[model samples]
Target: MDNDISKLKIERQPLLATPRKSRHLGRWIGIGIAVLVVTGIGFSMANRPTSVQLTSVTQAYPSQAITVLNATGYVVAQRKASIASKATGRLEWLGVREGSTVKAGELIARLENADLKANVAQAAANIDVARARLQEARAELQDASRAHDRALDLKQQNFISNAELDQVKARLDRAKATVAGAQSGIGAAAAGTEAAKVAVANTEIRAPFDGVILTKNANVGDVVAPFSSSAEAKAAVVTMADLSTLEVEADVAESSIGKVKVGMPCEIQLDALPDVRLKGVVASQVPSVDRSKATVMFKIRFVEKSDRVLPEMSAKVAFLERELTSHERTPKMAVNPAALAGDGKEATLWQIVDGKLKRVPVQRGEKLGDLQTISGPVKIGDKVISKPTDHLKEGGAAVVAEK
Candidate 1:
């Protein structure tokens, strides 16, 4: 019976069975695991927000759009003077030093005036002596005139000799001449006194205009002189500048000169005071051009001068095509230039709305410094992404980078 069961195809019921379907099932399970891993990775990637940096749309002006060029120059005072004494003498006193403000005709320094004062005293004494001599001459002339009249009367009455009358007349003439000589001496002495007073007045160095002292070139006991070349002589007692006359001398390139005009609006920046922006206008343009630097000089007068503005300080200026109003100085709408995505009259900026990046279109205008003028749905306070990723699309969430 065992031999017959073995012969029957069963041979014996095996403890384990090897099926072809098992190999295929194992392969199918591996494929399913791989698919789950790929799906999970994709889901994580799709949910991640794009990292971005953001800037604001700001208020700009009309002239900011018309700015044609920018150039660097220096702050210069159109009315600056070196205060010095016209008369050469040792400096006796200095009233103003560096940073001292003075008014027009204010005394800034004084020179040694001992000799001038002595000369004035001498002239006064001489005039007194001359005046005393004139009084004596007048008395003598009066006496002489009386004697001449008496002699003339006696001669007429034939009680005196003719020779006596002639002698008295001659005495009267000599007395008159003496009186005239004394009067002339007094006039000459008075003129000497006047000249001495003027000399003393010249010893004082005065401010020609209202200004601030920039330097104190001379000190007490220093010899001050005009056109002084001697090492011991100080030519300028103090250097002063009119703060009100402060202007910027900008060097505009020849190629860009055509865009600048007289009275064109400008923005001025000083290296020393970088945070404060100054408003100015193109006051004048130099007739000549600098060949060595290929630049034309443009003089810009500040609309409002600050006390911090100094002479010969480094500066930068932006020359616009037209003048701007006081309200225009403050921008109406502006944006960073980096936010612009395309090149044309219209600029494209990606804006974040409800945490999603959205493409915004704005009409581009002239630039003010680094800020660009724009007009669109975006207003002054709206924030826009500065730089966005290429893969970032409309309605995609963007995360502001902490960095």
Candidate 2:
């Protein structure tokens, strides 16, 4: 019976069970896979580009560092005039127009003077008539004198009576009086001619000084009157200005007026010619402040004059601490101080090249308004990282942040 029960019971199957070596191999494979995934994630995070902000190294003028004050104004001519005629007449001839250059005493216009010319001619004829009468009177006086001498001799020789000699003397005296009257008439006629000539000269209009005509206030056939209120009568012949006397008239705040002084050096920039920086000096300041604007007006004269500059152009003026030297006038390389990564003595900035960060060594210089002058391999327009942080390794890729 024991032998039959042993035959019905099931035996343990060792072949079907898993082996220890195989389980150990499977566990090690799972562990290896997990380690690989963790390593891959770490490597990807390290290789990813870091986002950064950048600023460009630019060329800046040295004058920006020393600028004390800035003001805006307009160009104006110091010597300007509205030319008008002193005498009233029709403008028969106009010899100049707008933009014409004229010299002092140059004839610019003429008035109708036919009647005046006739008066001069008549006065001249009167003088000639008076002189002819004087000549006749002198001839009579000479004849009377000869006759009187003959009479005196005859009376001395007892050939004539005393009453006859007296009559001859009276005739001679009468001729002398007639000659004096003729001479007086000639002098009066000469004076009349001079007065007529002066009247004729008044018809011509001439320039008062050297200047360029800015506008033609009167044209040919326009009547010019010195004090006329009628619409048809022109008061001015032209408006003119001396271009050489061009100056900048700037207004400064009354509180800041103390910083300005006569003869102080300044830089002028015209809105018309923005890129051109002109040299100037403070010429004068108005004695009183403007009550409405609460500002003081001052004049700035150009050190170097340009023909292109004109009156009434908008301009900006910078009052400098001192005149810039020849070298200082030129622009120099500059960068924002925040981009620098080291102390003043040993400075370094990250410059971007080929989409990667590069550490460039530079020497620090004077501090401009918001930038620091630097001498390095960087040129104008080169982009550099501002406020660099750790993990931004040299030769590492970087992406620029949107402005």
Candidate 3:
């Protein structure tokens, strides 16, 4: 039995010799391996993407390159007037409205003139009555002349006394005076008739010049006074302007007014029609400066007439150094100057393609305002890095910085 027990003790393998490895050592090593894996993941995340500011390629007008001065203005008519009647009366009939075209001496409206017409007719009738009276007096004068002739015959024959012959002569003289008075009355009546006709004509409103009606100030049944300050009575029947004399009135800063001059070429862009650019020339500069705005008025005339251009439209004018050529009038793709990575002929651009960096070669051209024109494989709307740094590399992941 003792020998069997000794063999069992020996089978314990010498108490398993004090273990060289601690039980917690393996746990600590596992923790260290996990920490290394997490650190590697964080390092990879930090290096994956670089934040950058980007700008898009855009189409720019060639005129921007040559623009010497820019100003805001409004379309105005050079020949504008408020059409009113000479006489005060109610507006009985209106033949025009806004946008109606009128010619010189054309009737545009009429006033209530029934009383004037009657006055004209009465004056004409008075003239006729005076003419009839003059005819009656002439007949009487003829009778008196015959009597006087007979009286003279009698006096020569001594058939009547001298006193009787004198009385007959007096009667003939009276008849002559009556005839002269009647003739004078006819002349006065004719003059009155002409005066009445003039009064009647004044009731008819006629256009003094060719123009287009811009506003209807007085409608039918409204009182129109020639010279009135009453609010109830309109001083003008309508407002009109000569569309052929349309012009742009721009306000140039007094400081920059020296840059502008008469006959300087200009390009006009109307806010109503943004795409259409109208050719123009500076017609005049107001000699006086506006005190409130500190600006000088510049009048510009259109070289080409456009039916689309209307009065009172907002406009932008670019006073060019020179007229744009046909090719330069077209729009070209452009970019900011900072987007180019290098100087001189070796300039390059960092383009962002699908969140990755791509190096593109570019040939710089003209300078438009603060932007630089370029010709390259890039198209409009392509996003490119602006102000690239040494850390930016081709084929690297990129992240757009929030503006």
Candidate 4:
């Protein structure tokens, strides 16, 4: 029985030893997998790109000489005027409002001048009364002259005293003086009547020029006074501006004022109209400079009429240093800015030669738009890596892929 117990203990020991050896084999397998994963990660990190992938474009670009002048200003009207009443009265009617186009001598508004009308009637009546008085004085003077003639004849025949003839002559002269005074009074009345008529006519306001009304200061039923010191009196009935005489007023720095002169070509861009570029010429350069702003104001007139342009519109002016040549306006060959590296001094690019990266040196020219002009030892059909990795050295094997 003791020998049988020893044999069972030995069998249990072998079974326990077999489980320990299997555990050790499983640990070695886990360690090998972990090492392979680390090696793969290190290789991927070493082959990663140094910079981000960028798109490269090869196309034509401009290489012309361009001078950029930064300037800002506003559009203004050259011919602007304010419409106001010429006589004091209540505004009865307004024929035009703001933004209304009017021609010269066109009625803009009318005033109710009751007092002026009455004065005109009174002057007309006085003129008639003065005419009647002059007629009566003339008749009396004729009658006196006739009587003096009879008296003179009687004196010549010795039938009357010398005193009687002298009295008749004196009466004739006095009647003639009374008629002269009545005639002078008639002339004065006629002048007063004409003046009253003129005052009544002045009550009606008219446009002095053909232009668009910008502002309407006085409305219907508002009292308008001519040449008043009060705030309301100083106000204009309507403000009008000529759209045809629109001009751009640009504030150019004092340093650049010397380059600008009258008759120089200018390109104007309105904030309201973005797609359109209007041509203009420097009309005049103001002699004086604005000391506070340290700038000189220049006036530019549009060469062509534009219906879209208005007074006081915001605009940007570009004063071209030189006109573009025919070839410069045309397109030229260019490549992506990212394709060429360095401060444009030494351009470096990666070219694919037989499925391997080949570093190539290139010469670059002026940048045009988003692409730059490149010229050197590179062909058009050759593929270039837009974003190259540090591991992608010359003669290095590479696999081409599309982004």
Candidate 5:
């Protein structure tokens, strides 16, 4: 019976919804999918980190080493002299020019000393004549003494009159007086000759100490004088300085003067030779302050002097509590100065943590090379925003730029 019913049937069921309703349902489904797609895109954007360039904080001992102060100065010579002649005369010879080395008592130059030499010669001849006169007077005095003795014997023996004996004694007295005068003349002549010899010696100019000539102010045939009022007159023969006594005279800020002390270890750098780093020590601090500049002068002596170094070259001094080791001189535990913000009294840094920038306060210390010392929430290996911008905010996600 079931087989016969299946053969008789076959009517189609009515559509569940009208064609418009089906269209409406399709439209709503598409709207929901579009909304879901946009929501996913927003979520993805929120999870993304910000794009930023980063710099790493260094870890090194040199940055942490104590740097007491920094000052600008120039290289100077401690023992410098402007050599000049003591008397007015034409320069006949010049032994040293610029960069010539000289020793103490070395003859550097000579003057026109012909007149002085003549004076010396004349004085010597006078001394000889005076001595001859003195000798002749002494011979006469001896003769007079013998004559007076004979006269006394004659008077005692009553062989001669008293008047004649008195006359002989008077003659002896006059001869003795002449001998004394001649002796005095010899002494005066000797003194005059010595004075003339000294005058001749003064015509030769000599070096006061061992040093190298820095400048040749006067040349051969130049007129040298003790005090030069005329432009042509040369006051100094040469400007010389003891190279061994070279020192750096730095001008330290008066406010920071307390940080500097005599014998402090220091590092010296010259502008002419930028690659060299010279070791030095604080030699002294000037007692007075420069009121106009508001600075104090300090001197630094080189530990190992270099032949390349010269006086008057520009230099910089870094005074330290102790000498810096080879490694400590390198950058360590430091960050780029640009990474620091809110400068002056207090400084802040934007240190990255978990891919986000975090504001942290730090104590700014002396500059190490181009990097600065920062004692704050940051540590070695920590990434910091280099050249932080206004868009970079605290706790904001930051993405480090790829090199």
Candidate 6:
């Protein structure tokens, strides 16, 4: 009975082992099938035909007149200056400081002028003394004249000797010489007084023109000089600029200089004020050219006054080909360059009409940069291919993609 029971247990073990091996084999087969199905789907998707979608933009006829040459420059005052002293002296008073609007002949600064003032006073006293001497000499001349007349009368009457008359005449001549000398001395002294007054005036600096004081180089107690190289000599007491007489100094390329002329209309755009466009004109073309830069400098003057404008503000100048006619001044629609096929003589563009690429003929005008002016039956809002592919033909079906 024990042997039979053992045999049955061995049989049960074989049955359990067979079932477990079969279950493991089934799991591997299921995994292999899943991988094969996934690979097949991936291959199928990749092989499928894909519809090519081309990127495109529309084109329209351009209308506005465009300027040819554009150059950058800086706004500068034509009559700007750095005012300095003509004579060396310690600055005693500064009448004007930075940002001070001054008129022509306005007093700007003054130097220590006590010495000059004293010299003028001394010169005036000398002139008075010389005048007194002149008066004394004139009185002597009158006396001499009376004596000479008496001498002549004596000679005529034969009451006095000829030698005595001659002696009286010599004395009268001597007095005349003294009077002339005194008169000359008075004239010299008067000239000295006038010169001293000029020196005193030089100590007081005045504005050369109507302007705004942009800088003040000297303060009270600073030593100012006539732009010399002494350690203590300050060159300029004040630096001013005429804001009303502002101009733009532009360096135009030598090649473009011929297109520019005096009085040509220009549109100025300041870098500081990008939104503000100022009207101006070509004031003058500098006669000399900068050889190193291969450019010609031009002067442009603004037509309108602007308080925002300042000296040395960077600017861009657009020199128009011709003054924009009243009709051309308004903004107009424009088209892309690729829309025009061929060499711009006769051009064609593809437009989608009824889900088809319809070829349209256009007459082309002058090219404005990368854009070209076109006249066609199409209107401004009409859609046209920017750059049509060679596969695109007349009456071909087009799948319009979202732009």
What are the lDDT figures for the candidates, one per model? Answer: 0.87, 0.89, 0.90, 0.79, 0.85, 0.80
TM-score of each: 0.69, 0.65, 0.76, 0.69, 0.68, 0.69
Candidate 4 least-lDDT 10 residues: 59-68
Models sorted by lDDT, best on top: 3, 2, 1, 5, 6, 4
Clashing pairs in model 2, backbone N/Cα/C closer than 3 A: none
Off by over 4 Å in 3: 1-61, 160-166, 339-364, 374-403
Worst 10 residues of 5 by lDDT: 59-68
For candidate 2, lDDT tens digit of each residue in 219-238? 88999887666678998888
Tell me which of candidates 2 and 3 scores higher on TM-score. 3
Per-residue lDDT over 28-72 for candidate 1, one digit per residue giving the tens place of the 0 to 100 score: 999999999999999989978888988887765555466678889
lDDT of 1 at 172: 98
Question: How many residue pairs clash per model?
Answer: 8, 0, 0, 4, 4, 0
When 1 and 6 are scored with lDDT, the better candidate is 1
Please provide, for model 3 over 219-325, each residue's C-alpha lDDT reduced to its tens digit, 9 standing for 90 to 100. 89999888766679988898899999999999999999889989998988899997788889999988999999999999999997899999999999999898778
Number of clashing residue pairs, candidate 6: 0
lDDT tens digits by residue: candidate 4, 1-403: 3666655664444454567889899999999999999999998876653333434445542422343464789999988887777777778899997778899899999899788989999999999999999999999999999999999889989999988988999999999999999999999999999999999889888888899999898888877887654666534788898888899999999988878888877777799986556777889989998999999999999986698998888998877665545565455556777776666457777776666667888778777656677777765545577765555577665665545
Off by over 4 Å in 1: 1-63, 325-328, 331-403
What is residue 224's positional error in candidate 1, in angstroms?
A: 1.6
Off by over 4 Å in 5: 1-65, 229-231, 329-369, 372-403
